[model samples]
Target: MADAAPPLQRLKGAMDAILVADVFLVMAGAAWFGVAVLCHSQKIEAPLQLFQTLWEPLFTPAIGLLMAAALLSGLLGWWQRRGQKRAPGTGS
Candidate 1:
């Protein structure tokens, strides 16, 4: 097993990349919304229109993906820890 990559290393790497992308999308969407709010308050209509146009298609999915990722990560970590607690050779 020395030469082989650790099991799920590639999966973990992919998940890491996806999670990073998801985080960035969520943050970018949030910043865009903030900018839109500022623009709307200042009567700058262009960005407000852009934000509204992108809201349903892009930002919504990004937000959902972030929420799902967070929940899944938490649940998986909890399950992993629970399994470890029952692992062989650990205290009864």
Candidate 2:
């Protein structure tokens, strides 16, 4: 028993894991936003048609949709886990 983590310690560890998940989700969202901006500003079009020719290809929308899904799912999962941790009987 001496080497075992106390109940409180275990609970804290679980909480930390939840926090890490939240952090990772936020970082991924930022990265996705950055990539979208990069694609929008590239020199793929002729001169003087920078903003006019955006989204000509399908990859732009596909990337945006995937990123949106990831963000939405990540937020939902984080909230669900947080609620579970705070529920009754989940004690140290």
**TM-score for each of the candidates:** 0.82, 0.38
- Candidate 2: segments with Cα more than 4 A from true spot: 1-3, 42-92
Write down the worst ten-residue block by lDDT for model 1: 1-10
Tens-place lDDT digits, model 2, residues 1-92: 36989999999798667656655655665565566567658843342243335434533554555577678879989999988888876573
Clashing pairs in 1: none
lDDT of 2: 0.62
For residues 1-92, what per-residue lDDT tens digits would candidate 1 score against the true structure?
35866769978998899889989988988888899899899999999899899989988888888899899989999999988988975677
Best by lDDT: 1
Best by TM-score: 1
**What lDDT score is found at residue 92 in candidate 2?**
32
Q: Which stretches of candidate 1 lie over 4 Å from their true place?
A: 1-7, 88-92
Report the CA-based lDDT of candidate 1 relative to the real structure.
0.88
